[model samples]
Target: MTSAAGATALVLALNKPVYPLYVWFLAESAFHLSLLTALTMPLYLAVWHLSRSGKGRAARLGMVIVGIVDTLAIALILGGESETLAFLFACLMLAGLSFYRSEVWLSRGLVAAIFVLFVALEGRIGAPLMPVEEDDMRSLAFLNVTGAAALAAFIMLRFPRAERPD
Candidate 1:
């Protein structure tokens, strides 16, 4: 892709973090997950292309967009009085996307911050932290997202990036 195309793609990654918000938190219907994931197809494809030979601009922008989107989505959800498990779940996936696109400490840090904020907001607000008695799947899904984020951070730390020159 050309530099401009790559740059735009990178910018679009900003929306990647919005996925898990619906997937993990707010989605009550199967349609929600399928629908939101479908919406994110372009975001992931752009990431894939950037991670290839699309150059530094695209890759960096993609990583940044991924981080910012999750943060923004959470803030919006939290402030709007709609902080559901589905939204948090979507944010978690967005963190994982950040983990994949850029091997940066900030990427991992953003996820960690979001996690803390998520837990704090929910607990402080009396939102359900644990699943209902029979909702083991939801519980497992939360743990899985947590595990994936840690793994992603470990990988990123182990493989530091070379600083690009301006």
Candidate 2:
């Protein structure tokens, strides 16, 4: 997920001409996007280290928090038109898949938080921090849609499947 986010941002930054609206006034919009995505790597690494240390619950909680906050921040930075909200759905999927059935409360709480955040911010948000051309928002939207889909698919594939009862 982290890698995908960074890669998408990089692609956007490198192909400025392809997204004129995105880079019209703020030629650095894509660059800033890449930077923000890169900044989340260390937090993801810390979560990985915690999981490796056998702190399963803490790691799961950390993942949920980091994923939610990161997605929300990106959505806010890009504004509603970029369709970055797609990543919030990815975050919800992560929370749902991160916990065992026994940890229902944690999963429910995290999912609810994501749901509330999505509802509150979806269309209610204002323009992006760095405004882009109206037509160019489609480019960002495409990147976000594919990025979110890839993240969701990767998460589903990587998570362990439940054992069947005899």
Candidate 3:
């Protein structure tokens, strides 16, 4: 997605009326979408830079764009930026991929709890994050919780069970 499209989608998803930080700014959906892209500068840059593989630049760019857009969509709709739900979930996804790649599950409880929390934050008991003027916090929480749990499970399944060495 072009940055603007992502932003416009995000603004609509999060702030449904979909204007701007300032109403007087006078911009189109395209403009708002661009803002969203600009808003996720750090994440986009990091993804674009870090992902170096046989995969070409276009692949990296596509993945980075997709990841950021999905992430922000999840964030704005569920937890608002302040909740940092996006960052946490992103970390969890990366961590799971890394740790599971190596087969480890020392952090099972943490992952489980995080999963539960993500789910709970969403639809259930749902309300938009405080000060966001919306209502979907429950859904956000629940999803985060679920994501965390899934990561934990992935780790547990991939890694060897912990046992004392005799």
Q: What is the TM-score of each candidate against the true structure?
A: 0.37, 0.78, 0.30
Can you give the lDDT of residue 69 in candidate 1?
A: 56
TM-score of candidate 1 on Cα atoms, chains taken together: 0.37
lDDT of 2 by residue, 62-146 (tens): 7778777767776777787878788888779877877888889988998998999889888887787865765667767777787
Highest TM-score: give the candidate number.
2
Relative to the unseen true structure, what is the C-alpha lDDT of residue 125 in candidate 3, on a scale of 0 to 100? 32
Q: What lDDT tens digits, residue by residue, belong to model 1 across residues 1-166?
A: 1333333344344434544554455333322322333344465456557767746545544544543454344333332223333344444544444343445565577567667766766534432232222243354345435534553454344334556999
Error of 3 at 71 (Å): 3.8
In model 2, what lDDT does residue 33 have?
A: 49
Each prediction's number of clashing residue pairs: 17, 0, 39
Tens-digit lDDT track of model 3 for 1-166: 1232233223223432322332213222223332443444445444434443333333333432444354545455333422435334643443333332233452354346446655664433332233332223333334445544553454345434446799
- Top lDDT: which candidate number? 2
Better of 1 and 2 by lDDT: 2
Worst 10 residues of 2 by lDDT: 3-12
Candidate 2: misplaced stretches above 4 Å?
1-29
lDDT of each: 0.44, 0.66, 0.39
